[model samples]
Target: MKINWAEDLRERVHDLAESLGNLFVEGFHYLALFAIGGITAWASVMAFLGMVEKGHISVDDILLLFIYLELGAMVGIYFKTNHMPVRFLIYVAITALTRLLISDVSHHNGPGMGVIYVSAAILLLALSILVVRYASSQFPSEVSAKPRTRRHLVIAQNRAEGDPGES
Candidate 1:
């Protein structure tokens, strides 16, 4: 195969562009985190004011507040740990679905769609939790099963040494 310098240069340029694009995507992820934080804070404050003005906080409003709180917590955890909890996202989705159901049930029409939507959301939450649980169990945070302590190792060695004689 004849080496084409021009083609090689074109490929290198393409790779550089791709690398820059990936960097931009990561930057946007951080930007989204900030945007989410701002929006959640604003919504929480507005909800609090609405509660004060109404003199009564409905259950739906309380649920919405919880969703916002979960969102804020998720964002905070991401900021601190550089990762968000899937469980928290599932909880938020479930709570939002419940809030929607509560808000819609009292209306005279189309409760079926609300019920179906809520049911789907609950199913998705359940599946997500199951997946996370399975993944955590399969691939635990601890990389090894070995004990790190010299004392434990000595004890295990002694136990192994004595096993043949005892048997």
Candidate 2:
């Protein structure tokens, strides 16, 4: 019987390299998400403080806050599920366009072509969100479409084997 030492060493090396690569990618994701989350929080605080100093919340101010909220929610959902909800982005865009429309109207004292264009854009974005939601619901992906972390796999296994342990 021949023991292939060279092949064994090569296989070990490949696996070690792959593990290290995965570790690095995971660490990078954590760092980036933390930074983004922290920035969103800080910006929200600053915006709130600005509104307080101004002594009144304008339409634009409220809309800006809504944008921040949507951003925070997006970051949180991505952190928890690792799935970026496209609807959140569409919500942000809608909020931003509404803000712009409000700003334009207030500045111009009346609606203009810009208002029409912005309104149309917002409507399109809303329709796109509806389409996305309908498509996701009507054509759900395979179970494997979602990335299964070790924790999720363990929970699934527990449920499958009737362990009744931590799910």
Candidate 3:
């Protein structure tokens, strides 16, 4: 059997192009993550310096640091698992809202419309996080917690294995 030169060349070029594209995408992903890590570190350091200069750690400072911490954790999670969990974003939102509410109530003479709105936002974020957790446990598209994602997937597909939805 004679190998077709044109077909062989076409297949080789296609494979090379695909591999090059993958390498470029991976490189860009790492570059973005590196920038994010650097920015997060810089912000954390600035916040720490501010706290030190003030000689007292306030709720606002603590909340800012928490947001920075969550951002760093998010970047790390993406770098490690290649999946960004929505729960972390919700957590950050809740923290930021709480920080806003604290600042508004403390700085103002009384609670205003902003306080009510921020409180509502925070409550909604908390509820969202709970709903996501429940859904993840119940529906379980992937076995992600403890047992293993593959096992969870199998369990979800097999009813005799004790379905989470049934229980």
* lDDT string, candidate 3, 1-167, tens digits: 25698876876687677667878988999999999999999989998998999999989999999999999999999999777789999999999888888888888869778888888888888999999999988997763544333333555777765555422
Ranking the candidates on lDDT from highest down gives 2, 3, 1
lDDT of 1 at 110: 64
Pairs that collide in candidate 2 are: none
lDDT of 1 by residue, 35-69 (tens): 99999999999999999999998989899899989
Cα miss at 24, model 2 (Å)? 1.0
TM-score of each: 0.60, 0.81, 0.78
Best by TM-score: 2
Candidate topping lDDT: 2
- How does model 2 fare in lDDT? 0.88
Lowest-scoring 10 consecutive residues by lDDT in candidate 1? 142-151
lDDT tens readout by residue for model 2, 1-167: 15698876776687677677878988998899999989999999999999999999999999998999999999999888777899999999999999999999998998778888999999999999999999999998664555445555677899899887775
Model 2 root-mean-square deviation: 5.8
Mind sharing the TM-score for model 3? 0.78
* Alpha carbon lDDT of each predicted model: 0.81, 0.88, 0.84
